[model samples]
Target chain A: MAEVEISQLHKTYPGGGRPATRDVSLTVADGEFMVLLGPSGCGKTTLLRMIAGLELPDRGSVRIGGRDVTYRAPRERNLSMVFQSYAVFPHKKVADNIGFGLAMRKADRAVIQDKIAWAAGLLQLEDYLDRYPSQLSGGQRQRVAVARAIVMEPDVLLMDEPLSNLDALLRLQFRAELKKLLTDLGTTCVYVTHDQVEALSLGERVAVMKDGEIVQCGPPMEVYDSPASEFIGGFIGSPPMNFLDATLRRDGGEAVIEVAGQRSAAPGSWAAFAEGPVRIGVRAETITAHRAERSGALRAVTEVAEPLGSTTLVTAVLGEQRIKVQVPPDFPVGAGDDLWLDLRADRLSCYERDTGRVLVSDR
Target chain B: MTAAGTAAPDRAAAPDAGVDRAPLARRRRNRMLVQVACLAITAFMAAPMYLITLAAFSTRESLNAFPKSFAPADVSTETLRSFLGATGVVPSFLNSLVVGLLTLVLSVAIGTPAGYALARHVFAGRDAYQLFLLFTRALPIVVLSVPLARFFITAGLSDTVLAVALLHTALALPTTVLITASIFTAVPRDLEEAALVFGCTRASAFRQVVAPLALPGIAAASLFTFVLSWNEVLGAAVLTLTNRTLPAQVLGSLQWSPLPYRFAGGFALLVPALIFIFVMRRYLLNMWGTTLR
Candidate 1:
């Protein structure tokens, strides 16, 4: 319903070390789901809280629905937040919990009742209307929290890791349900989480943050396939991207990249770098592992192989570097097996060895 | 020879089975010991009330009889009736009730907000303020009573239920603030934030979300305030003369009165406190039973 614009937001707690957020700006399109994803202590939650009007930024303005709401209180902002703890009122029954916001607005009793019923039905909580929160399981309490937020029909919805408290299996189910529910409702949402998979699956666009700054923000696959920095290439993938030390040299008409004593031609974009040393970044799944010795392939000693139904993750040592390689589930390899790894040239990313910034990307 | 050998092994195996039974028997014995100790403590606490009620309802002559019977024989209401009929006794009893109720109201009214601030905010000197409250309690009432009485006289409020109530409030506020702060602390901050995000203002959020959860704790503080005000004699005695509470009014005359009247006065004072505790028992249990989510 409302697009949120946050600009130049900075917040530093008293007795501060590093600021919680620094010069952060983001715009969430109307009805678009934006996920702020990062590890703990990375300031993603701080940015979300600033947008919610829960925490005041030291220097920034937040505009929601084209209105300047930077100084407004949370209730005045016409937004609802689902806390990580669910935070359902324990003293109230599920019906009252869902109806709290409408009651706060002094809605008509009949309308409040209708809205409560609709939300309960939507959340599959009709049978639990009369039950106290203590009687509900973790997942049910979370549903009650979601029902409460949606019943208000606020301009925007803010969720701070709302699914984190549930058991792993319930988190997955609720994650899917939440995505479907929010999509059906078409409410502009800003979700904060430390989960990469949740961000990759649910977000219309994922904003990955580190050390109080947005490192990369893009469509999930775009960010995954073309991480802007070495930090991101390692952060976004399962088993993460592998980084290997390599030397780059001009070999006549082409740049030759050497890793672990094996040589391959660099992508054409790398012709600009007067090569000495560079880091090679490759996804685990992009490298093909062969049992036989192959020409133009680096040899690695497998340390461990984890069978994960669809794929086997093999951690192998090539030279002094440890790298993960995704192989077929039935790949016949185990500890101490020799594997000839063919690093696909099209999928490889080259980064500056000292700066960890990408020098050349295949795409 | 085979029978002897088999019997020897069976005897050896019997001790292994007894080893398991030993701990079970010891556990049962320990449980019985705990039950017995609890019974003994209950009797120890209840003995005085039994004796006082028995003595209070006895005929005046039976109290002075040569062989005092523990059984309630020759029961009469003569001494209790006379005690109630004593000049200023009923009035002082009413005064005590007013003072206790007033103390409960005033302490809770002033203490709850301070408690909430302590629980919710991180102000400078917060820890020092808490320590100051505890220090105020360390000062004996005997030291504060005369000055407090003088201050009340100067304000033209001496010798009234209000004066006694004010002194009692001062006495009870530290515990009231501390107890309610702990109660409020147990209510999650997340609930308040959720209320704020859901359309409730700060005040309404507190009233709707926090207060209901903290009600039992507030009740506990009120109970403590009432009992402290009810039983306190020195401060009441110092602060009031004509508007004396029950304990203050009786302490002056009862020590010189006959034993029956003394017993009657003691029994009269004990009943109201016991009744107050009985009334607030449910809320007190709720305070203990609460488990935060």
Candidate 2:
């Protein structure tokens, strides 16, 4: 097990739009599963490739186990990678593909065979070692790609959307299996994916990237509970967080938000906060749908109600603005019905309209 | 979308020919005509090659005694042995092998990498180089031989098999590059990247991964170059005398002695050409496959 330190890493492509990776720095401790999470073209793959030494960074160094390897060749760096395309050797048998690195290192035949057998068994491929890639199914090919990487027993393993090619059922199954395998082998893995749920489920710490830089990096639960910015708040959830345009005013030593011409009185604990037009974001679960309440935030009409089995999602308009809330499926709600919503003040995050910076906490 | 759709037909009114016909009979008739024409062309091309093979294997008596029969009455080793005798034939035959091998080696080493660079890497004057190679190939050998022979004489390279081999390589380069370039195109660039990510160095990646995969097409390209060198006589005759290739030796003596050995020598010269074509038939089809795709 070995930690990776990428210090001030920058990659400027030949034909520049911007730096593909702009002064990004991150550290992963030994045995930590860190996922570089982002949408397509966000430079997550470039970061992983650079860390693998398959790509060279323009202006910074990548160190593994405290050894600098920015200019090292892939073999010299000793990191195994599984590509998004499942880059298994199509011309080789499963056994040879898995044992490719061992063969390169001039390992003995018996050792290679035993290692190949162990990897094959770990991936549940006892019967297909002699088969070519063209003869296998998509899931099997993915297993082969993973098996090939793991058999090398390198210091780190970089996986670039390794399950993106598999079917949904197979992806879920393999994701769990891969997590277990990495844990058992005690290899540091840096997984890259755009799926936030996959990052949450797999990564011990998820680093959210956008526009060639990491905007937030934290434990998955920490990132889920307290997003750092408006972008992160809107990006991390399934139905996403609800944000309504509002103006904050200081009145009688409390912060009051005027949303859609209706003033939402703050809880008095947030009285010393900023006072101006701002955007208020609340997660879907934080906005509770009730008939009417005396102590909480607002009264509104439920515009659209969707009963999604165990939980229900209701899109409600607080005056001129619409927001979504998760409630019980059997909650009394339907389209064009009036309802009351108790906005949880402690869980609320307010962002400045001009800056989009989260003012709730240093999250 | 409607605005864009109207642009194609606004200039004309008589548009009956543009509509697809719905009748099955017309389509079937057109298909049948195409099939029959295809069959006729296939048989037309097959007939000459079939007759040539019959004549090549026929005995001297059977070849001379008739309205040429499709079935020769006799086939013997006497004519084969005489055609491969030591006095002149064996030396010339050995010369053909050497020239073909040299031509194959030289052309392949230069052509495949040139093709890859053309297909992949982009640099200034690349198109100019390609056009230059094409122009070199388009010049007929007989036209260039006059000036080339003078240059060879000046360099003291007169009457050598190497001179003829170099001339043949120049003739084969354009086809070799074009074919191998198309073959490399069919194999994905991702596979090359995959090899690099594995433990291979850049050159080792090419040697271990890309080379084995490109072998069939390279084999076909080398085969074509060898055959072209073997069957070449016009330049070979001008370039060499003591080490004349088989085609040069045979073509120079074609009519002076109409002995059985003469006909047999012609057959012997034709044999390797036929073998090369047969060996590369599948890959030649693959070349077309890759081209169309």
DockQ of each: 0.74, 0.44
Cα RMSDs, all models: 5.2, 6.9
Candidate 2 stretches with Cα past 4 Å from truth are A265-270, A291-303, A360-363, B1-34, B54-93, B116-128, B185-190, B231-233, B246-271, B285-293
lDDT tens readout by residue for model 1, B1-293: 12212222344556476555666556666766777788799999899999999999999889999788999999899999999999999999999999999999999999999999999998899999999999998988889998998899899999989999999999999988987888889899999999988888899999999999898778877997899999999999988889999999989886678899989999999998899888877666545535432
Pairs of colliding residues, candidate 2: none
Alpha-carbon deviation at B167 in model 2, angstroms: 2.1
Once fitted onto the true fold, the runs of candidate 1 whose alpha carbons sit more than 4 angstroms away are A360-363, B1-44, B65-74, B282-293
- lDDT for model 2, on a 0 to 1 scale? 0.82
Instruction: Write down the TM-score of every candidate.
Output: 0.92, 0.85
Tens-place lDDT digits, model 2, residues B116-195? 88766677898898788789867777888878888888988877888888888888888788778877876666567666
Per-residue lDDT over A90-156 for candidate 1, one digit per residue giving the tens place of the 0 to 100 score = 9999999999999999999999999999999999999999999999999999999999999999899
Model 2 Cα lDDT, one tens digit per residue, A1-363: 689999899998766778888899999999899999988888899999899876799998899999999898887877888888887777789999899888878899999999999999999887999999889999999998888888888888899998888889989998899888888888998999998888989999999998899999999977876787888878888788888898878887867777777666665655667677788888899877777665445778888888888899999988888899999887887888877777776777778787787776332
